[model samples]
Target: MAVLLHRLGLGAYRHRKLVLGIWLAVLAALVTCAGVFGGKLDDRFTVPGTESQRALDTLGRTLPEASGAGAQIVFTAPEGHHVTEARYTAAIAGAEAAAVKAPQVKAVMGPNVSGAVSADRSTAIVQVQYSVQRAEIRPSSLDVIERAAAAAEKNGLRTSVGGSAYGSNGVHIGPSEIIGVGVALLVLVVTFGSLLAAGMSLLPALLGVAVGLAGLLALTPAVSISSTAVTLALMLGLAVGIDYILFILSRHRRQLARGTDPQESIALATGTAGSAVVFAGSTVIIALAALSVIGIPFLTVMGLGAAGAVLVAVLAAITLLPALAGFAGTRLTPKSGGKQAQRSAAPDGSDGRATLGARWVRTVVAKPLLTVLAATGVLVALALPAADLRLALPDNGSAPVASAERKAYDTVSDEFGPGFNGPLLVLTETHDRPGAQAGAKAARELRDLKGIKAVLPPQPTHDSAQTVIQVMPETGPDSPRTARLVRDIRAAAPGIGEATGATVAVTGATAVNIDVSDRLSDSLLPFTAIVVGLSLILLTMVFRSLVIPLKAAVGFLLSVGASLGTVVALFQWGRLADILGLAHTGPVVSFLPVILIGVLFGLAMDYEVFLVSGMREEWVHTGAARASVTDGARHSVRVVTAAALIMFTVFAGFFPLDDALIKPIAFALAVGVAIDAFAVRLTLVPAVLALAGRHAWWLPAWLDRVLPDLDVEGTRLQKASRVVHREPERVS
Candidate 1:
């Protein structure tokens, strides 16, 4: 691999113009296609084979009205005022009439409808039923609904349009995203110390991200791409792109400072660092692509989208970065007597003054047992909050506080009851016509359920073989009690069927979300085992050490545990909510843990390979475990620290966005990267390696022979280079 990468890098560098032009042409083509072919991003969360999904699909086939998206135009009258007043009633009636006239609006129930007005008459909800699913509901249709509600707002009523159909799931790029890139550039500048070098490091990464994202968008017309998936792809692409380029660029500059030929340095850096990049990126790609095994469409899309972006970043790092280096020639070399030059000239890439990584590793090695205990204790303390972690799909109630959906959610909770926002549909299907009696019996049985707040009369379809009954729960949608109620309803379905001669199923927006959450929760354990097992095998292959891989896996778990705990504490438990700008806190996003494990596993392994490979290389060359640990720390610590900060900054940049879906995921990745890179890989890893001594690199001879040599550290390339240098070139 190293030899092939060396040849590829040399070819790209020698043909820099062609390489640069090829990337540019690819970028242009993708961007153009995206502009022409990109379609709307759907936010639909569908889990096939779930009971709720099956019921919903049946309704879509038999009774379209019940399966279509529903929106609520919640109106709240002023304090001490009543919506029963003639003017308020008239305005709400006007909105409902207008809503009915809107395209694709099948039905609009006004405040005059039974149970539509609050008991105190201070609030009313005008329900608008669309003839399409949430994803298919046109924006213009929603616009008409909002415009129609203007009359109610003028009548001294607070009007908020919200519901399943009003969800804002479009990917919007804001100042925060730009600021993240800016911060990443600042990190690059500081790390490289040369503006030209910094810009060069950032350019290839940006180009790679552009191509990746553009390609993803271009496929949106054919695929049901979601906003969350795009945001994740962008986030991962940018973070990894810059980090990959930085790794290779930093290595090239180090070699340049050592007075190596510019072309030779580029080849060597790409061959060595680029090899690690490929191995590290493969771990991430494999982990993400493994999402297919879960059999969830949206999650599979998210994982594959992110994996595609990372793959592009790796290609750009190995090919485009070296080509760009060829253009820069010797200019990237640090100036004589400069800080970088002086540091690079040292035996361990540090000047007379010891680097912080070196000093810290020395302190850690001096008390390996204590270091391990202290680090583990801190991680354990942070991980305690994970025990309290709750997972749920976000709903209107989880929207930004200032959003219309949240306002409507709050008003409905305050007036009509929280359960009104997420009513469960008890679907009853009979084998024959005139099944009204069975439907009525099913409704009667549902009313007797423990969590039942109210069971509406069954409304049979034209054939009378299917009946839809609305069952409102006592608690809110995201409430644990509501999840329990969903299970209770399903459990009671069999008894209801036996008593009424009708097959009953539970489905609604709320029930579907509950099913989605349950599916993700059930899949989490097996998915984690797969990821952890993959990590063990991959790390073993790269480092060729049983103990190191084991240590790396343990360190990964600690970082993941601590990261998840922090997310639970901040986002779920609402700890420091105000400081973090959280509008509301309840359950964490259902898929966050799965995503964190997959992404952070790859990244944790990235740092693990980069750090441990250096140690292994030094150990192989000198057979001095203790000295190798410190020497490796001194050599790679600066690049690793810079890379982690760049990744953290890029991810943290998305933390402040108003997007409920993107915000928590970004924060988790940011926190996870920081903890894994700094605390585990740098601090705990060195301590463990120092303590393990000669045994740290141990591998059984039989096992070693069985495992193919990956040569991620470029040992073969290093020996080949030495052989070439020993034999002088003959003029032909």
Candidate 2:
């Protein structure tokens, strides 16, 4: 494996111009194709075989108007004025006319006919129904609708639009990618101290992300994915890309400083760090692939898309980075006479006794018990809030306060009720018109329920075979208490429908949200267990250690738990809610657990591999576990911390996005990267390794023989290190 990687690196450098030109051509082709044929992304989540979906399908067939994407054109009258006033009425009419003129709009129902005028007559809602599916309606069409609604302001009326269509148009998914790249560039420059070096590291990452996004856009017709998928693909791609380049670049620079020729240095660097990159990238890919086990088509597409991008990033790191480094030559190293140059002068690492990291490791080894306990305690305390985590889909209540959707949500909640923003649709199949009366009785019964605020009268379908009732609850969509109301209604629905001789199902935005949340919640434990178990097995094979893999898994879980707790506190409990731009306090996003587990666990294992591989090499050569622990920690800390900082900066760049779904994701990943890299990898893992001593590397002979040689750090070059540099007890 090391030989193959070394050859690939050498080849990349030998034909550097060809490699660069090929990548350029690929990028050009991908961008050209994307501009001409790329499809727009949209959110179209649905869970088949669920009661909510059944109800939705029934409604779509019986009443086509309610089938397509929906939007509400909201109008507010002048202060202390009634919506029925001449000017306000004219404004409302004008807004409706504008909506009607939209080619995509199938119908515009409003005022008295739609029962949308507020009781106080100060506000009104005009329902705009589209003929096209939600994903089929482009943002430009929504822009036309927004402009039409804006005309109401000319008549002294304040108009705003809200719903899936408007909210979809509000998302700017690609800007965060640019911000992430900018931050990564800065981090690389500061870490490497050379513009050429930094560009070499960042260039491949940018190209990989661009190509990945272009491919994702082109794949949209065959594989359905949301706009959120775009953000995630770019985020993960940029992060992994930069880290991959950093790993190889750091090693290549170290070799150059050691007096090796540039070609041999690049090849050896690739053989070692490139091997780790391959294993780490595979772990990430496998973790993401686990999402396929959940059986959700859209999520599967999203996970695979991200995994594909990561694959590209890894490949680019091995090929494109080396080629660029070849071009960079001596400029990749720092100038003479500075601290870096002084270190470079000590090529054999024989200039001194110990580094700060080695000293810290020695101290921890002297009292491993205390260090391990203290680190464990800190992790446990930070993770406490995770036990009380609540999960739900972000609703209008969670949108940015400045958004039209959020304003509409606030206005409706203030005037009508929080529940008005997410009403439940009760659909029932009945034999005849007499069953409509029974449906009305069921609606009345719903009104008597504890959380019920209001239940509108039942209306029969055009064929008179089905009846639909809209029931408004007292709580908002994202309320922690809302799911209970859904549970209660489902519990009571059967008896009520049976008595009425009808078959009933609950469906709507609120019901779909509840169902999706429940499904995700149910799957979280098993899915997490699978991911952890798979990672543990992989680690066990790579490191040839029983205790090391177990300890690594525990440390990773600690980091993930603590990060989730931080998100729950910030996004769910509303701690720092105002500062974070969260419109309201509510449950965290339902899929956060699975997503966090996959991403954080993969990264945790990645660091463990990079750090431990160095220690494994030292131990194998010196036959002294304690010294190897100190030496490996000393050598790897700089690169590991730099990589972590780059990842943190890229993730943190997304904080200002203010997309409720993305903000928490960004926060969790950022916090997790910080904790995993600094706390778990730097402190806890080393302490545990120190305590375990030689036991940390113990693997049963039979199992060792059975397991595959992962070659995680390139055994060929690592063995060469011992023979080439024989200085005892060096600074590293």
Candidate 3:
């Protein structure tokens, strides 16, 4: 692998223009094609076999009009006035006029026309049914309805809109990317101390991110990826892209400072650091690919998109970075003669020198148990909030207060009831007259059930073989009470279905969220076990140690737990909700843990491989555990911390994104990377390795014989160094 990468780097350095041109061509092609063929991205996920999905399928086949997205134009009359008053009549009139102007609208049921009014007569709902699913409705198509709502508001009545269609406005790139880039530029310049070198590391990464996003957009027509997938891709792409470049660039500059020729330095760096880049990137790709095992389409697309971005970033690092390095010449080297300059140029603490990184390692090694205990205590304290962690889909309760959906939710909950915001549909399939009669009887009985606010009359389908009953619960969708209510309804469904000789399902927006929450919770254990197991196997192969992989796995879980617990405290428990502008305290996004586990686990392994591989290399060469620990930490600390800082910044930039879903993801990744870098990688890993001593490298003889040897650091580059030096023994 070292020889092959060395040769490739040599070729790229020799034909630098050609290599650069190929990347540029790829970028141009991606941009042009994606622009022409790109389709809109959305989150139109449905869990197969879930009651909500079953209800949708049945509706699509039997009552096609009912299958499309439904929007509620909620209206509230002025103080002490009823909706039937003439003052509110203009608002309804304007809405009716707008409905007539709107396209793809199947029907509109107004309060005056259909008598859909609240019990207080102060609130009324105008139900607009569209001809297509919410996923199929473009944001622009909903603007006509919005304009009508605005016109209605001009009257003496208060008006708001809510539904899946109103919920999805056009998604745009937020200021987070720009903010991330600005911060990255600062970190790169400070780290490299050379404008040309800093730009070299950053430019290729930005281009790779561009290509990745373009390719992802181009895939939208062929594959329906979630809209948020693009944001996630951008966040991850920038991070890995910059970090990959940082790895190779730092190594190349170190070789240049050692008086190696530019081309040779680039080759050796690519052969060594580039190999780690490949391994780390592959680990991330494998981890993300495991998301497919969950059997969720949106999640599969998200994983694929993120993995593809990482792949592009890796390719750019190995190919474009080396080619660009050829033009950098001596500018990659730090200036000589000053204290700061000397320290910056000292990549590996030469002349048996002890740098701060080395000093910290020694201090930790001196009292490994105490260091480990302190770090573990900090992580445990942060993770304590996770004991109360709750998971649910982000509903209107979590949406922006000014958003149409939130406003509509507030208006409806205040005027009609909170239950009116998310009504459950009780669907029953029957084959005989007695069955339909029994279904009606069951619907009437639902009114007497606890937590149910109202049970609408059962309406039979065209064939009279199916009956649909709307059941309104007392609580909102995000409430724990709502989830309990759903469970109660489902439990009672079996007995009712049996008595009616029919199949009954609890299906609605709230029901779908419950189903998703249950699936994510159930799948969390198996999914985590699989990812952790795979990471263990991979780390074991690279480090050639049982104890090493076990420790790394524990550290990874600790970082993940601490990060999630922080999210729970801030977002779920609302410890600082008012300051963050959160609408209310509620469950974390249902899929957040699943997404965080995949991303954070992969990122954790990235640091693990980079740090441990260096230590393992030192241990192999010197046969001294403490010296290797100190040496490796001193050598890799700057690069890993810099990489972590860049990643944290990139993720933090996403805070400007208005989407409730994207914010939690951004927070999790940013906090996770911070904890992993500072607490786990720097503090816990060294301490644990120091205490483990020789056992850190211990693998059973038989296990070693059976396991394939994978040298991620390209140690065989020592032989290649001999060829470059023209001396067999002076390879180093």
Model-by-model lDDT, in order?
A: 0.88, 0.81, 0.82
Q: Which regions of candidate 2 are displaced past 4 Å?
A: 138-148, 169-180, 333-338, 341-363, 431-438, 717-732
Q: Model 1, residue 387: what's the lDDT?
A: 92
How does each model score on TM-score?
Answer: 0.98, 0.93, 0.95
**Model 2: per-residue Cα lDDT over 1-732, one tens digit each:** 777898999999889999989988988888787678767676766777789977887777776555567788788888899888987787788778878878778788878676777789888988888755678886677886788778888888888888755564323555665777687788788766667878889888888888888888777666677877777887899899999999899888777766667887898889889988998998889888888788666667768888988999998999998898889887776666555545545642323556555566677777888998998898888899888888888777777788898888888888778888888888877765555777777887787778878887787766576778888889888775667888888899888877777777888878887888888888898988888798789999888999988998888888988898888788777788777666667788877788888888778888998888888878988889888887777777767888998899888888778677777888899999999988788888888988888999999999999999877888866677566665643745
Over 134-186, each residue of candidate 3 has an lDDT whose tens digit, in order, gives 76876666888888888887887888888656654344565666878789888
Alpha-carbon error at 213 in model 2, in Å? 1.2
Residue pairs that clash (backbone atoms under 3 angstroms), model 3: none
Candidate 3 TM-score to native: 0.95
Root-mean-square deviation of candidate 2: 3.6
| Model 3, residue 71: C-alpha shift (Å) | 1.7
Cα lDDT tens digits, model 1, 187-206, are: 88888789999999999999
Question: Which candidate achieves the best lDDT against the true structure?
Answer: 1
TM-score of 2: 0.93
